[model samples]
Target: MQDHTVISSLIVRVLPDHGESAAARLASIEGVEVHEKLEGKIVVTIEAPTVDSSHDTAASFSEIPGVIGVDLVYVNFEDDPAVAKGSQR
Candidate 1:
């Protein structure tokens, strides 16, 4: 089966005191990348093989001890292997 690539960006809000820890936790999750972090907000990008997986990754952010909210900012899905290969040419 061809892989479906899903890319999403999220904003995660955490307790001010736990910002660093929360960012580290988020970075530890598979397929999650911490792009930027402020006092209590983190910008993250999740790359997965499917939309469900991407959503699951984002949802997991909310389960962190100090996380207050998870907001999805952007999402994209790419499922064309031929187009993917063609792009590389």
Candidate 2:
């Protein structure tokens, strides 16, 4: 089987005082990248082996210190090779 990954972006709101700490935690996660930060919000991208894992990873952000809310902003789904083989171009 071929491996496909799901890529997505999220807006994470955090307590301003702990913004840096939260971002560090997010960056420590595999497939999670902290891109930008302002006020109390952070922009991040997350990738996972599957959709369920992607959502789960996003939800886990709330566990970080100072995290207020996690909002999914964008998603780029990868084409599954097995499924692609059955479809016509």
Candidate 3:
């Protein structure tokens, strides 16, 4: 872990019949924010403590019931924590 903040945005697709349940489930996950839902697609944002966790979180979205796909739109890892790890501040 680099002590950096990792934020990622993604789209999750599900069958239209399952959109509501899937969106609720996704929003219940830690650090997962469900932004919008239309048709069978949902917009979401995930905030994780590390880059690897961000990936893991995204991958887990596929396991949700009725989820057809998880498409990552963007990921940002704030700065380089490694550069300041040795400093007291």
Candidate 4:
């Protein structure tokens, strides 16, 4: 079976004093990447095997201690093939 891959970008707002810590925590998540952090805003990306997983990952950001908001900025989905079938003899 093939699995769908979902990629998404989010803008997270945190308390100014906690931005650094928040970024660190976000970067720790399995498929999350913290691209930029300035003032109280953080730009991040999350990649998961499914749309539901992506949403769950994004929602997890909102549960972080200093996170004030999570706004999804972009999303993309692609199918992953289960196996390669090219052969020649």
Ranking by lDDT: 3, 2, 1, 4
lDDT of 3 by residue, 63-83 (tens): 999999989899887542532
**Residue range with the least summed lDDT across 10 consecutive positions in model 3:** 79-88
lDDT of each: 0.85, 0.85, 0.86, 0.84
Superposed on all Cα atoms, the candidates' RMSDs to the truth, in angstroms, are: 6.1, 3.9, 4.9, 7.2
Worst 10 residues of 2 by lDDT: 78-87
Q: Please write out the lDDT profile of model 2 over residues 1-89, one tens digit for every residue.
A: 33546789999999989999999999998889999998999999987776777888998998898999999999876564433555655
The predicted structure with the larger lDDT, 2 or 3, is 3
What is the C-alpha lDDT profile of model 1 across 1-89, one tens digit per residue? Answer: 43548889999999999999999999999888999998889999988887777877888887898999998899887663544666798
The 10-residue segment with the lowest total lDDT in model 1: 77-86
Per-residue C-alpha lDDT of model 4 across residues 11-82, encoded as one tens digit per residue? 999998899999999999988899999889999998788777888899888789889999989988644222
Q: Which candidate is the best by lDDT?
A: 3
Q: After superposing candidate 2 on the true structure, give the runs of residues whose Cα lies further than 4 Å from its correct spot.
A: 1-4, 78-89
What's the lDDT for residue 25 in model 4? 97
Error of 1 at 21 (Å): 0.3
Question: Scored by Cα lDDT, where does model 4 land?
Answer: 0.84
